[model samples]
Target: MNSLLKVENLQMHYFTSKGAVRAIDDLSFELMRGETIGLVGESGCGKTSLGTSILRMPTPPGRYVSGKILVDGVDVIPLPEKEVRRNIRWQKISMVFQGAMNCLTPVYTIGRQMMETLNEHSDLSRSDAESLIAEYLGLVGLSPEIVQRYPHELSGGMKQRAVIATALFLKPEIIILDEPTTALDVIVQAQIINLLKKLKQQFSLSFIFITHDLALEAEISDRICVMYAGKIVELGSNAQIYGTQSPKHPYTERLLAATPRLFKKVEQLQFIPGTPPDLIAPPKGCRFSPRCNKAFDRCFQEEPPLIEIEPGHMSACWLHHRG
Candidate 1:
């Protein structure tokens, strides 16, 4: 069977006066129907950039250099902006942005905003739009009465659910969730996570879950893709990523080391020693070489390609491809 989404050699950069910042560099991945791929990385690793580029909504100064964002076998890259907006975006794929409060318009009632979305995307009449708004809100565990309230009227969790509801209003098959549980309290975060799992099962939705939280990613993702300095360092099934076998990429290993694990005895939680390289002037060889404890002569002089380490696991590390 064909993949639901195929991103091949995707490159997105932010053009600045100084130079182009390679936010996404030769990235490639695929999302199958009903599969959740967790994109985990430190901030500035291009996780959000990848999400936005896939949606054909890269912010100003950011533009796609080359690559294909294939949704259901159709490439969205070469399409006209109008066509992408009218057909692809929010129609086949939708995004739930990072901050719920920031994404929602504080000036408008939640209902009005959702109604406007429905109007822009479909021929749904006001009655149909309102019904959808109510149904989606309820699906996200919100009340029908929430339509009357402004964004500020809702709690953090409620605001998040509202954003989720809006994203689902179009019934998109794929959803890119960017740090969906950012600032909410622990309880609300758990609720949101559970809700996402429920919705994924109910709708058979594919998700590109972007976040810095590895533990949370483990809870929701079927596969985990580790990114560093705008490139994917490791991509593997959850068992290969978080299970007994260790990560092949050094970056992945350090990231796992840094995360605090429950029911595990640890004298000290380790941290990756160095900061990520500047995207505009990333290191000459392996982007992670500057910080990789396993870096050697080849690591400093040659960039290793992301190669399959096993049947379903891929890693970009010289150690894995020494030949």
Candidate 2:
């Protein structure tokens, strides 16, 4: 495989005042070059944590207990913070966080912030840096004048586009976008999604798109990974996971059932019945067993491993477990 990024047995945990929370538990996956992979899960299910951990930029209280994050076959997990900041981040991989408001510093002008990032990474003159930044902003449908505006001055969609532009300015091979269109209206969401699609092709980029909506994933991703309780329950091509009548995992099916389809008549949208398991004190068996319709006695007693049940599809569940 022409893998651009590979995460192996990744475990990221947060040591809160209460207890240790496993934000990412034994997660593993790969992103092929120029591929778009969607990560979908409910809130606090490690989607954001996984995305942050990919850049090795965990906040306080969070730590990478064990894992291998490789970019272009080079292991990044062992790199020092300085090395990661200088070489790995933004240069090889970058992230546009969930909230655009949080992404940009309100006090700083967009031009100054973008220039600082550009100059820090490359030894470019002020004029050269501004020129390059403007070029990138243009790629994301922003005008050069946006550089002079503060974060508060731009519209929500514009702020998101600016953040995306900053991410792509470094020309990174992989970019992780966490709910890029979360707060925008439907029309704006479509516009941003379209912009992303165009940029990906323009730069031959690979993307990890994280969102709560599976329907959105189906619209853009070549493959989608269903995350639950800090672990991926299923991973497959969009066709195998969504196009098929039966998804290998019950959790995946329930998610699809819960999604509201436009212009499609349905009496009611099915809802997944329970709250997600507490990460600080997660169940010992399958993390998703509590909500899985196909759960059996064994499922509640032992955790399932992610194993391939089809040519390119992998799922962790008792129904597909071969042991």
Candidate 3:
């Protein structure tokens, strides 16, 4: 499969009053054409930062610092701000942000927002743009009448559908969905997930789906990348990630144990002890070693590099490296 997007050693650091915070540290991954890769991690683990970095959105105190982001073999990192804006940003890549309900302006009608996005990216006239907006709304299983309503008038699920419609209005090749269903009801969430799967197949769109929900990722993701602190600790197919082979990385195993199984009712559920390390002043070696039950002297002193353990499975842990 051809890679639609390739991110190499991507780093996004924030210079705070305390010190330099490594929000995203040496992250690298590839999105194959029409493949869904789930990025799962606790909040503040650089999932959102990674998505924004790809789109080159305003980072404020955050800086790209280093690394290369290639879209269809084109090095997007070196491109000027204007060129990235005019050529690449929305024309080729788009994002459906978390809290899509709050993302839209309450005062503006759904149709107007979609039109603004369409007109900004393409040379379509008002009528042509309106037609396209209606088409996209319908594509997401939304009624065309919903377009005329203000965001405040729509339900949470409907607002999300409209937001998705806006993101897909340009028909970009890659769409980054950052916890798109987090705020919806369970039934609504399932509906949105189904819509996304349908859209991916219909348009052959590649996606980087960011969420903390492991079970949800297992259902929708082709491959899963488990993140800890500011790095990808494990990358593998869904089966490799979810199967009971005892994950090589202690953190990955803990994450799997934390996932709630529908058929099982246990008195106590396992939880990963201790919170993620502060990025402002991260630990010298493994950020997860403090909480990792399998931590050793080597894990606490040496930062492991991501290495392939199997054909498509990669893990960054001293245990895996030692074996």
Q: Which candidate comes out best when scored by lDDT?
A: 1
lDDT of each: 0.91, 0.89, 0.87
By lDDT, the better pick of 1 and 3 is 1
Pairs that collide, model 1: none
Give lDDT tens digits, candidate 3, residues 178-259: 9999988999999999999999999998889999999899889999998988899999998898877656678878887898
Q: How many clashes show up in model 3?
A: 0
Superposing all C-alpha atoms, what RMSD in Å does each candidate have to the true structure?
1.2, 1.6, 1.2
In angstroms, the error of model 3 at 86 is: 2.1
Model 1 Cα lDDT, one tens digit per residue, 1-323 = 24899999999999999999999999999999999999999999999999999999898799999999998888899899899878888988999988855678779998888888888889988888888888998999999998999988889999898889888877899999999998889899999999999999899899999999998999999999999989999999999998888777889898989999888979998999878999999998899998888899999888899999899999999998667
Pairs of colliding residues, candidate 3: none
Candidate 2 C-alpha lDDT tens digits along 1-323: 49999999999999999998999999999999999999998998999999999988887799989989888888898888889878889999988988854668889999998887787777888898889988988888889998889988998888888888888877899999999888999999999999999999999999999999998998889999999999999999989987844688889889988999998879987998989999999997998888878788999999998989988899898787546
Error of 2 at 165 (Å): 0.7
Q: Is candidate 2 or candidate 3 better by lDDT?
A: 2
- From the highest TM-score down, the ranking of the candidates is 1, 3, 2
